[model samples]
Target chain A: MLTILLQHTVFGIVTGSILLLATIGFSMIYTTKRFLCISHGELLTIGAYTTYIFHVFLGWNLLYSGVIGVVITSLVGLAIARGLYEPMERHGPLVLLFTSVGVTFCLHGILEFIAGPSIRSFRTPILPSIRVGGIPLITMNEIVIISIAMGSIVFLHVVLTRTRIGKAFRAMASNVDLAMARGIDTARISMFVWIYASAMAAVAGILLALVTSVNPDLGWTQILIILAAAILGGLGSIYGVMIGAILLGVVMDVGVIFFPSGYRAAIAFALMIIVLLVKPKGIFGGE
Target chain B: MFRRTRIVRRVLVVGLSLALLAGLSVGVARAEEVRFGVLTSLSGPLGTEGKPCFETIQWTVEEINKFGGPLGMPIKLFVADTATDVERGITGARKLITMDRVINIIGPSSSIVVAIMKFCADNEVPIISHWSGSTRLTTSGGEYQFRTCPDDYFEGEVAARFMWDEGFRKAAVITLDTEDTISISDALKKRFAAMGGEVVVDEMVVGGQTTYRTAARKVLAKRPDVLFPAIDLDTLKIVYRELYEMGITFTVVLASNAVQQATMDIVGADILEGVYGEKPANALGSPGYAIFEQKYREHMEDGMVGWFTPNMYDAVNLMALAVEVAGEATGKGISENIRKVANSPGIKVYSYAEGLAHLLRGHEINYEGASGSCDFDEFGNVLGYARIQQAKGGQWVDIKFYSSEDLAEAIR
Candidate 1:
C-alpha cells in the first residue's frame, strides 16, 4: 500500500512538472497582458509539429530539431503578438481574449490541414525502464522530461529575479503605466514575454509529444488543464503557479485512489473552484 | 416608331419563352441522374477512418457508373465532412438533404447516424451506416436508418463467449467514456457475470488523455485473470504501454474496435503479440472482395484499407440495388427495398453488376457484399458474424468464426 502511494506521488510529480512548464508561459503572458491567451496552446502544437517535420521529414538529429522547433515557435509567438495582439490591445480584454480563441482555431486548422489528423510517433528508440525502490518504474524519457522541466524552471527563476531585464519585466507586470513612464520600453518587454513564454511552451510540447503520441489536438486537449493550473496558481506569480501545478497534478493522480480515473479533470476543476470561492485571488495572488 | 416598338416587344417575348423552355428541359435532364450523399469525418481525429470510407464510397460509385449505373442513369455523389462532431454532422446532413437533394445517404459512423436519425426519418431519407456498432442507433425506431456493421451488443456478447471459452474467469474491463465503448463494456460485464464469471474491475477513462498510469494502476490492483480494453487506438496504446511498464502480464481480450492494422502499427506489434480480439469478417475468398482490395489499393495513396472500407463499398452497392429494385430514386423507395435486396430467398449475387443484372431480369437477388452476407433485421441492424483473431508473428490471424446465432447460444 505504501509503495503504491509512493508510485502515484512520483507519477504526480512528473505530471506536475509538465503542467508547470505549460503554466509558466501561460501565467507570464497573463501577468503582463492581463488577458487569457487561449492560442498559447497552439504554440505547443507548432513546436511539436515543427520538430516532427525537421526530425522525421528532413532527417535532422533530435537535438537539432528540437532546438530549431523551439526557436521557430518563439519567433512565431512574437509575430502573433505584433501582428494581431498589438493592434487589438486598446480594444479591451474581451476583444483580445476572443481574438486569441480565433487564433487558436486558426492554428489548429492549419496543423490539421498539414498533418492530416493521424497520430505521429517519434522515431526515437524506446528506452528500457529503470525501477527505483518504493516508486513506479521510470523510463529515460521521463527522466529527461523531469530534468529539463526542473532546469527550465530554475533558469526562469534566475532570469526573473537576478537580471536587469528581469527587473524591468517585474515593473511592467506590476504597473505598466509606471514602468513605461520610467523609460522601460513596455512594448519590447511584452514582446520578450511572448517569446520567452512561447519557448517554454514549445519545450513542454516536445516533452509531451515524446511521452505521448503527437496529434493535432495534443495541445488543445490539455489547454483547459493548463488554464486551471494557471488560475489556481494566481495567474501572475511564477513560483505560485509551479506550486499550484504540482498540487493539482498530485491531486489528479492521487484522487484516482478514491474516485475513478475519468474524474481527474473534474477533481482538478473542483479544486480550482473551491480555491476561487474561498480565496478569490488564488493562493498567491496579491490583494 | 410604333411599328419599331411593336417589333422589339415581340422579339423579347419570343426570347423569354425560348429561355423558359430550355430551363425546364435542363431541369428534367438533371433529374435523370441519381445523387447519393456521402457524409463522413474526412477531417479531425476520425479522419483516418473517414478518409478510407469516403474513398471506398467514391470507388463504388465509379464502378457502378462504369457498369451503366442503376436504372440506366449515372450515379453522382455529394460528399461532406462531419469532423466527427455531432453539430458538424447535423450541418453536413442538412446540406446533403436540402441542397444536394440526394436519394440516399451513406455515413461512416453510428454516432453520426444516430444524431441525424430524426432528421432522416422526418425527411424520409434513408441513411446506410458503414461502421456504427451502437445498439441504441438501430433500436431507436428510426425507420430510415440501416447499419451494415453489427451492433455493439452482439460484439460484447461475442467477447464474453470468447473469454469464457478461453477459460478466463475473472475479467477486468477498461473502456473509454464514449457511448459505444461504454455500451460494449457494460454488455460484456453483464453477460460475463451472468455466465458465472467474475468482473473484478470495471473502469472508464476519458479519451484524448496523455497519461493512463493512474487508471492502469487502479486496474492492475484488481489483478484479474484477463483484461478487456474497449477503448480507441490512441488511449489503448497509452493504457497498454503503462501496463507493460508496470511489469504486469495478463491476457488482454480487446474489443473489435481496437483490432485494426492501423492500431497495430501505431501501438507496436511487440506489445500486441498474442492479444486476442474479434472483428466483423469479410467474405475472405470471394472474387468480389479480391477485386475490391485490388481497386482500393490502386486508388488509396497509403495502400492500406481498414476493415470497414469493404463495408462502405457494400453499403453503396446495397443502396444502388435497393434503388433499382424500388424502380425509383427516392428515400422511401430505397428504405422499403433495402432489406429485400440484401436478405435471402433470392439468387445470391456478389458484385453490384451481377446483382443489378439479376434485378433488371425481374428476379430476386441477395447481395453477398464484399464485407460479407448482409441481412438486416427489423431494427435496421444487420445479423452479422465476427471472426476471432489473435496477433501472431506480428500479424492478425483468424482462428475461429462466430455467427450471430453461435454467439447468442454461447451467452445463453
Candidate 2:
C-alpha cells in the first residue's frame, strides 16, 4: 500500500506539472483579458503540429523544433491578440468569449483541412526511468516535463514580481481603466502577457507530444481541466493557479485508487465544485 | 391566318413531345444504376483500418461491375469519411442517406458504428459494418445493422480459451471506456471466470488521457499472471511504452483489435515481443483470399492486411448480392434480403459472381466469405475462426490456427 501510494503520488506530480504549464497561461489570460480563451487548445495544437512538421517533415532535431515551435506559437498568439481580440476589445469580454469560441472552431477546421485529423507523434529520445529501491518509479520524459514546468513557473514568478513590466501587468489586470488613466502602456503589457503565456502553452504542448501523442483534439482535451484548475485556484493569482493544478493532478491520480479510473476527470471536477461550494471565490480568491 | 397559327402551334407541340421522350429515356438510363455509400475513417485515427477496408470495398465493387453488377445495374459508389469521430459518423451517414440517396451503405469503424448504424437504420438505409461487435448495434438498429465479423461474445470465448490453454489461471483486464471495449471486457471476464480463471483486476479506463501509469501500477499490485487489455492501438502505444520505461512487463494477450502489424512496426519488437493477438485465419492459403491479397499488394502502398479489410470486401459483396437476390435496389429491399443472401440453409458461395448466380437460379446461398462465413446469427454476428499470433521482430507471425469448431467446443 505504501509503495502504491508513493508511486501514484509520483504519477500525480508528473501529470500535475503538465497541467501547471497549461493552467498558468490560462489563468494569466483570464486575469488580464477577463474572458475564457476557448481557442487556447488550438494554440497548443498549432505548436505541436509546427514541431511535428519540423521533426517529421523537415527532419530537424526534436529539440530544435521544440524551440522553433514555441517561438512560432508565441508569435501566433501575439498576432491573434492584435488581429482578432484587440480589434474587438471595445465590445466587452462576453463578445470576446463568444469570438474565442468562433476562433476555436475556425482554427480546428483549418487544422483538420491541413492535417486531416490523423494522430501524429514524435520519436523522442529514449529516456531511462529513475527507479529507486529496485522498483521503476518514473520515466525521464516525465522528469523533463516536471523540470520544464518548474523552470517556466519560476521564470514567470520572477518576471511578474521583480520587473517593472510585471508591475505594470498587475496594475492593468487589477483595473485596466485606472492603469490606462495613469499612463501605463496597457496594450504593450497585454501583448507581453499573450506572448509569454502562449510560449508556456507551446512548451506544454510540445512536452505532451513527447510524453503522449498529438492530435488536433489534444488542446480541447486539456483545456477544460486547465480551466478547472485555474478557476479552483483564484484565476488572477499565479501561486493559486500552480497549487490548484498540482492539487487537481494529484487528486485525479490518487482518487483512482479509491474510485474507478474512468471517473478520474469527474473526481477532479467534483473536488472543484465542493471547494467552490465552501468558498465561492475559489481557494485562493479571498486573497 | 388561322391555318398559319395552327401550323406553328402544331410544330411547337411536336417539338415538346420529342423533348419529353428524350427526358424519359435519360431517366430510364439513370435508373439502370444503383448507388452504394461507404462511411469510414478515410483519414483519422482509424485510417489504417478504414483505408484498407475502403480499398477492398472498391476492389470488390469493381470486380462486380465487370461481371454485370447486382440486378445488372452498374454500381455507383460514394464515400464519406467519419474520420473516427462519432458526430462525424452521424453526419456522414446522413449525407449518404439523404444527399447521396444511396440504395445501400457499408463500412465505418466500430467506434462510430453504433451511432451511425442507428442513424442509417432510422432513415431506412440498411448499413453493414466490418468492425462493429457491439450488441446494441443490432438491438437498437434492428434489421438494418449488420457486420461481417463475429460479435465480442465469440472474441471473448476465443481469448479466454487461449489464456486457459496457456495455463494462465489469474488474469488482469484493462479496457477502454468505450461501449464496445467494455462489452469485450464483460464477455472476456465472464468466459475467463467461468473456466475457473480468476480475474484479479478489471479496470475500465478512459482513453486519450496523458498517462495510465497509475492504472498499470494498480494492476501490477494485484500480480496477475496475464493481462488482457482491450484498448485502441494508440492508447496501448502509450501504456506499453510507459510500462517499458518503468521496467515492468506483463504477459499480454490482446483482442483482435491489437493485431495491427503497423502498430507492431511502430512500437518495435523490443516492447512487443511475445505479445499475443488473434485475427481471422482468412489470410491462410485460401485461393479466393490469395487473389484478394495479390490485388491488395498491387493497389495499396502497405501490403499487410488489417483484420477488417476482408470483412469490408465481404460487406460490399453482400450488399451487391442482396440486390441480386431481391431483384431491385432499394434500402428496404436490401434490408429484407441481406440475411437471405448471407445466412445459412443454402449452397455455399465464395464470391459475388458465384453468390449472384446461385441466387438467380432460385437457390438459397450462404456466402462463405474471405473473413469467415458471412454467416450471421440472430444478433447479426457471424461465427469465425482466428489465427493465434505473436509479435516477433516487428511483425505478427502465426502461432496456430484456432478453428471455429474447436472454439465452440472449448467455450461450451
Task: Show the colliding residue pairs in model 1.
Answer: none
| Index of the highest-lDDT prediction | 1
Q: Which stretches of candidate 1 lie over 4 Å from their true place?
A: A125-129, A134-137, B1-30, B287-291, B294-305, B404-412
Candidate 2 lDDT by residue in tens digits, A1-287 = 77778878888988889889888887788888888887887788888989999988898998899899999999998898889988887899899999988998998888877886356778665444788887777877888788888988888879889999999998988898999999999889998889988888888888877777777777878888888888888778888989999999999988877886767789889999999999887889923
- DockQ metric, candidate 1: 0.46
Chain A only: TM-score per candidate? 0.96, 0.95
What's the residue-level lDDT of B351 in candidate 1? 84
Error of 2 at B192 (Å): 2.1
Q: What is the alpha-carbon interface RMSD for each candidate? A: 2.2, 2.4
lDDT of each residue in B147-265, candidate 2, tens digit only: 88766767787788889999999999889877667777788899999999999988777888777876687677788889898887668777777767765556888776556765664
lDDT of 1 by residue, B320-366 (tens): 99989988888999999988889998998988889988887899998
How displaced is residue A259 in candidate 1, in Å?
A: 2.0
Find the number of clashing residue pairs for candidate 1.
0
* Candidate 2 docking class: acceptable
Shift of residue A12 alpha carbon in model 2, Å: 1.8
The TM-score, computed over Cα atoms with residue i paired to residue i, of candidate 1 is 0.92
* Best candidate (score: TM-score): 1
